[model samples]
Target: MSSATRRPNTNCIHSGTRIDPAVGGVNTPIHMSSAYLQPNPQAPETCYPRYMNIPTQQAPADKIAALEHGEAGLVLATGLAAITIPILAMMRPGAHAVFQADLYGGTHHFILAEMERLGLAYTLVPETDPEAIAAAVRPGTTLVHLESPTNPTLKIIDLAATARAVKETNPDAVLCIDNTFATPMNQNPLDLGFDVVMHSGTKYLSGHSDLNCGAVVTSAARMKAIRETAVNIGTSLAPFDSYLLERSMKTLAVRMERHNANALAVAEYLERHPKIGAVHYPGLPSHPGHAAAARQMRGFGGMVSFELGDSPEAARAAVQRLSVIASAISLGGVESTITFPAETSHYKMTREERLAIGVTDTLARLSVGIEDVADLLEDLEGALAAL
Candidate 1:
């Protein structure tokens, strides 16, 4: 079915999976074999590894392609693998890339350090400003990477505007969006004119945090390039991990709904709380991009961040007192997670660097889950009291 005609729930449940009549099963069976059997008589090439025709790989890839509203998809072993493969596939020596100032720390490290080692050029710009991005673009720039509702800070970028600007001045430059925060159920950046859409399947797409997989979905031609890079680099996801991620994706619609609701409630609560210095969530009325978020996303999303009234030590104490919310780094699980970006995600950046980019020690990012809102609030209240 066309993505435009399908409901989000229908897309999530049935997008990538078609039961195999041979197996007579409702779900895609996990084809665990690294190698597949070729038909008898060395027939017209039945299947093989390191190439194409693997049901395990094809199943998830098809699903993500459909969900992201792209012509095709490629799966990788991990989110960073997904990110890196595309860079390698698309970039040449001396090519420059423009990226958001605030990105997932691992991604920043990859571009800032690893890309330099590989002799590539990059510029960091505030993704919210299209003009800044335009200014950063050099004659050799070929890619503009963005992360909307960016990690920890939840900054929003005008994807459509940025894509148009990039394509207008640099027709060959491809705009890639990290769609992990707002899953396919929420936004389709390709439809917004982005050239490619990437997902960290380790997050909301997998839902359960039980698997580590990444996806790159785009036009068929782009998919071919990504596939070549993925297999050649040995970054393709294992069948078992693909199965787990596919299973988790089936419930994406329901989980994202709860995630949005819980996040909204938490944002509102924190907004009015006496101890909270500031609350950052797209659902909040005061948020800079609340209207744009409503326009592009069906829901606000699962993540939230707030500044504490006390010092960094007090913030640490508050998180330590929380019983229901786990103090951890990754997010988008059945349970809530909280972390201090200064120590967890942005620690590698120096103090001045972190402050310059708005990641402060007092900033506590919360990944709201499918938990009871009241219980989570109570836990936060208790934590605040301790602080």
Candidate 2:
């Protein structure tokens, strides 16, 4: 059976598997060429790395594309580039954008700083209800952007409802989501009605903190414009990084199993502790969006957020006490890490702005890794005890 038609776990290993013709190598060999020979000079199409047509780049792109059930995909130098290129391509003069306020700080800051400069008007929707999203859509809005299990907050956006609302309100508007946190193993936004799915491959998709990469998956029709923009902007990922990303995905299915299990166990432990004020993880029934997440997501993601206390000092002290989990900025690696959002991801936002979006000074965002649940729980317990 073809990999695409097979189950997702199988697709991870074989969807883009094209054996080396030079030898019977099991893995796709890295084609370290910037140029490829064209049979006809006037043929108009030629294999090029920047064009995202070469085998090395296409292999990983195809794997993620199939995983998300998208018709096409592209990898970029950074997650910002992957997301920025598509939003810019889809927007023409006089077109606007609607962005959910709870976002990765970089994306949120980009909208606030760059949209108007680029001549695109935007609306920031503060709420998650699909009705609110539909209500915010203007006739000229060309893009609607959101992230599920939102950064540092663990808020779940209703993917299907939000997509339906966006399309029904403005069919021309492209509904794009940052699927970085959930990863394809937990959720496929395309299957839930989203038009485009974006990922910071630096996170779960790469499953390691060693590289920086980004990916976009969407229908073939919409990707044409994004591809053109990306080529012009020179953001295509290198062959070696693409190869590594493809290899990382081979282990995604197995790694995420442990991530999901360990995360749930950790979140439950945190929820019961006297020091944890509020635990935000969809796996817990107490989470506000638990019902929607249960309906839409196959597994509650490995990320968890909680309130440490009223002061930022307490949050800082707790992280300093951690021995096993690193207090780091980036997430989704095999090693468990924690971040104080007030000092890291959401640091750019003013105190009032952070509070407005439910990001308190005490909020700690935990990227649960594939560690033994007992060790992870103990690590977190040691950290929280310092509070």
Candidate 3:
């Protein structure tokens, strides 16, 4: 089925499949060998590590490209690697990038450090105002980047409107979006006018915590550049990890449904709880970004962030007391995870900067899983009670 017409779930299962020629096996076999032999010296087919595109990697890349509604997709070793390599491919020395200030700490660190070494300049602005983003664009700015439902804060940037403004002001600039948190199930940034779409495939795309990978999906022209850079840098995902990501993608639709349900339930529960000073979830009516979220996202999302009336110590205690949820740095797994952004993800930021972005000592970020909603709520309730 073509991506244009196929449904999301069907794309998930069929996008990357190649039936076994001899046995008609439904699953693609893992091509573990790094190299392949050529048929002849003059007339050849698939011969080297650099030349061979294994079934395991190609199938999943095809599927993800279809699922993301992009011309092509390239896989990478990690989300940060996926993000940095492409920007490097597009940017020249002295080129500048304007980006949202609110982002995953890992990504934030990479951009800050790499740009300095590359002689690339950047401007980080609050994404809440489109005008602020426009104002940050300098004469040499060649890229505009952003994350919606931004990390820890859950603030939404109006993607379509921002894309339009960026294009209008800097027609030569490429607009890229980090679709990691939202995933393609909820939003298609390319359709909204983004030039490139990136994902930390280690998260919801893989659905499991085991594999760490990333992806860049966009138009074929852009994909060619990303793929060349990916191969040259040796950042492409390993064959086995690609296989795992493909397997996880097969259940994406169902997992997303449960994640949405559990997240909505948990957000509501936290909003009503006496100890919660503020809860930030796009699914909630009180959220400032709810309208834009409704327009763009199919489901709100699984990630939820909220603050308590207590201090950082109490927040740590709440996480330590949870019966089922684990305290960890990662998110978008089958099991729920809780983390303190001010300490874990965004620890690189100073205290003043963290607080400025609404990541306070009391703030806790939850990556809701597909577990029973009732059980999750009870676990959280018990933890908060102890706090």
For TM-score, the strongest prediction is: 2
lDDT per residue (tens digit) for residues 1-387 in model 2: 865678988999998867887799989888899878889999998988889888888889999999999999898998899889998888877888899988988898888777867878889999988999889998888889999989978888888988888889999888899999999999999998889999999999899888899999998988998999999989999999999999999999999989999999988998999877999999999999999999988899889998886688877887888888988889999999988887788888888889989888788899998877898888777777767
* Highest-lDDT candidate: 2
Q: Each model's TM-score, in the order given?
A: 0.95, 0.97, 0.96
**Candidates 2 and 3 compared by lDDT, better number:** 2
Q: Rate the local accuracy (lDDT) of all candidates.
A: 0.84, 0.89, 0.84
Q: Candidate 1: worst 10 consecutive residues by lDDT? A: 44-53
Model 3, residue pairs in steric clash: none
Query: Rank order by lDDT, top first?
Result: 2, 3, 1
The true-versus-predicted C-alpha distance at residue 317 of model 2, in Å, is 1.4
User: Quick one: RMSD of model 2?
Assistant: 1.3
Question: Model 2, 110: alpha-carbon shift in Å?
Answer: 1.1
On the 0 to 100 scale, the lDDT of residue 237 in model 1 is 79
Off by over 4 Å in 3: 40-52
- Tell me the spans in candidate 2 whose CA falls farther than 4 Å from its real position: none
Which parts of model 1 have CA positions greater than 4 angstroms off?
Answer: 1-4, 40-53
